[model samples]
Target: MSTTTPETKTVLVIGATGKQGRAFIRSLLFPSANSTPSSPTTTTYPKSENWHILAVTRDASAPPARALLEEAKSHNAASKVTLVEASLNTPSTLRAVFESHPNIYSVFVVLAYPGLGAPVTSQREKEQGTMIADLAVEFGVKLFVYSSTIPIGPDANDGIDESRKQKREVEHYIEDLGKKNPNWKWIVIRPGFFYENLEGVFGAIGTTMYRDGLKRDTTIAMVASEDLGRVVAGLLQNPEPYINKFLCVTSGPVTMREVLNAHVRATGKPMPAVPGFVGWILLKINKGAKDLVKEAEINHANRISGKLPTFEEEVERAKSVCELQTYEQWKRALVSGEAGGDGELARRGSTDGKRMSTSSWNNLSLMKLLAGRS
Candidate 1:
């Protein structure tokens, strides 16, 4: 295991126990971090050269936190990882994290959704995101990386979701902070649709709905959590070229048919999807699902009609920073247990192991949302 000397730079990762945070930690600590530079022009860097991670979580001793520590230990990175008990809702503790770690060179901010034990409001989400950005400036951190959601492409801004609007406000705040402080530097990465959204019971519902409901041949932009981490690590390693930039971190686009076909190719079994009528009924009856359907419909229409801008340029940029995997590549890795966090799918025929449990299901306000209760 590596030791944190005075020269070692630290990084404070918010939402450290969640999928996105875990992916970032793995990219920082794991020896075989997933990064495939797609072109000869893309630049690449070695993994976890001389870095320490302050893995921030609400509970330092929780199973997921413990699992992260254990994974790092197995990779000879135990000394490089530290579990920090903190919450974004509590600004004092968040400040304490920066105050305590003077050598922290970068901060990775990925705020939680559905609030902390409350419904997710745009105001609450924006408050939490901007608070962290403000804290980073106050602490004089060199780089601030915020993982944001997808942008509303080629459309009137007001047509987007409220939560999305709040995130954009946070991005604006970061940019404003940079302009006001000449010495400040930051990068905003807006990851496309998540592949993990196709993993468990919720995935079952969502995948089935999309597959059966959306028009055939309509493609959607997607990214793997593993790849998102690599992209962040690259920017952290080399922040000069991308200062104040927004990277669309994605593995290009894939259609619903292609997504299902990839699953069959990897596992030799068809994906579990509900019938068309059932999916249509759920979309009509469930408010949350209905909203999801509405969003998908807009995206699908844009994609099919050539109104959706291509993500080809974004994928190429990501390659220059880190190696990226296509959806098929990720699916193959997932089946062979080669991909990071592939166990849930490999062992159980379902992904999102952490989210499949009864307690986990109940804890997520998002899960309640899928059930039309939130």
Candidate 2:
């Protein structure tokens, strides 16, 4: 864990509705509001005057997002977090949010604006990257914790995955921010795929797959959302000397078989069998194959060695962290589609059973996962 002087500071976080932002927000406000505001000279607008937080969001009125804001306010965090319009297409919209507050100590850019038109490009990245850094510089905010992703290179034998492709532009610009400026605290956290995306499998709902009684295989390297939240919280709470650096955080990775067994232990069920075409057929009979095909490819990659976690350990930890029922305590929970509720559990949100939020799945602040100092 990194270290930062403890004090009440204002924070400006972009993409607050997404998983990463939500985690970041919850973590910041959850335990306490010990945040620092940015300096005056470094940011586009001075954010060192007072403690005023602004959250950038695409649609402030969306139910789930609105619910989050309502929760924040209910928690007496009305003075801590506020939702403001920040669209990916318009960089100024985002800039306006951070600039809106002259007292922001830290600015967590959760998403980048679509530069020009391409999915990933330095034009958009550099512009916003520079703007974010400039705001930090102008505001005197010592920390500029932008969320980033891992460039799927060497460690990622997966042939420069899609995320890497999108990251090309962001990586260069942010690296430039680190090199050229070198003063503001800039870091990235490049994490692996999240575990929350795994609950919607055919087996979870009870449709078995049988190809000559030989089940298909599903592999995965998944990260826990709370872990993601925790590290972000920990780093922000204590960014010691790691500021202005990039590092990775993961509990470790494992396979579907391992994961299912743990889930079974929690739910008191038989080990889930990985299904084949029959499962796909069952899916087609019920939901559809578009998702199944993608799952198959993901499973294939996991089986081949994707960055997943040790299923057994994750389940054990989840039992404690997620308050999962012991086998006897889980039957009804599983059937009712309500395994975890309250107690830091992932909330039920849109995007089908995605335990985490949207920003994570669609790639929010991959930088925070990739290069966070404190």
Candidate 3:
């Protein structure tokens, strides 16, 4: 048996209390200590013991942050993970974090979208992301990994969501930084729709939009955020081949009806579909809902016309790094309680562990949309 080296390198993770952060830390700290590479010619990736995670959060006392620490302890990696409080919106605190940890080997950033239940502008999102990238460069970090969203169309501003544009801008900034700084590198992992998006208040809204607004045959690209974490950790272990590459990550494409059926099989309860007219009204009135639905429609059309890449090749590339879980597999795990409840689901106010809240509407916009009154 080969003995792996002790953990020496440090990786600072931003947004450490969120789904992507938790998953990335978990995958990085406990990625099957004895697994071998699938390809004979491929490099044998580094073991979990070779890296330490410095998980950055805004509050160390919050439930999610506490949960992260407990989860690490459960895996017997408590010593390997440390939680540090730092607000991403405040540059001074973030700079202090980097100044305190001068030996940070790499950075993994996943900024919150629709930040903290408050409406977020594209410029605000861009500033937060670019600030982090600039700090990483100043700190002389070796590898910087950013979790971004998949492209909706061929052009930069084609996507309806402003967040997509911000992500693209950050990607471009990282690429430029890498060109100027020869000592370090960067990688962007652009993930498609997260499985968690179908599990809470957002889930209900998303499912309604999917069932009523999208065409029957349209297949949306999807991936579990957990799989994205493992893929990032695995890539960092062998970062040479994928340097400065924008990897499109997806498990596969499946129709909305297919996803609904899978949810039924998992929970033994059918996902309720809103009336077509209600969905249409929501799409007409709510810019967020309308843009999201329109983006999916555009992606579907571009895919059929071959104007947009399907990302089949990118999926294959991701598979080379980590084993990806299909939607069916993830649904089974979620229902079986093998996988923890999605952090986003809980954050979005999932009252009873089912899809959405049964109580009064805390998010009025979503409620209005559901009622066709938005």
The most accurate candidate by TM-score is 1
Query: What local lDDT score does residue 177 receive in model 2, on the 0 to 100 scale?
Result: 62
Q: Give per-residue CA lDDT, model 2, range 125-210, as digits (tens).
A: 44555566666666667677766553333233333233344444554566776676666676566554554544333223222422
RMSD of each: 4.2, 11.3, 4.8
**Structural similarity to truth (TM-score) of each candidate:** 0.86, 0.61, 0.84
Error of 1 at 5 (Å): 8.6
lDDT of 3 at 137: 91
The clash numbers for all candidates, in the given order, read: 5, 71, 0
lDDT per model vs. reference: 0.71, 0.48, 0.73
Mark the 10 consecutive residues where model 1 has the least summed lDDT.
33-42
**What are the runs in model 1 whose C-alpha is more than 4 Å off?**
1-6, 33-43, 46-49, 115-122, 154-160, 300-312, 342-371
Candidate 3 or 1, higher lDDT: 3
Q: Write the per-residue lDDT of candidate 1 for residues 221-294, one digit (tens) a residue.
A: 78877778778877887878888877888777678899898889877988876577767777676665565556
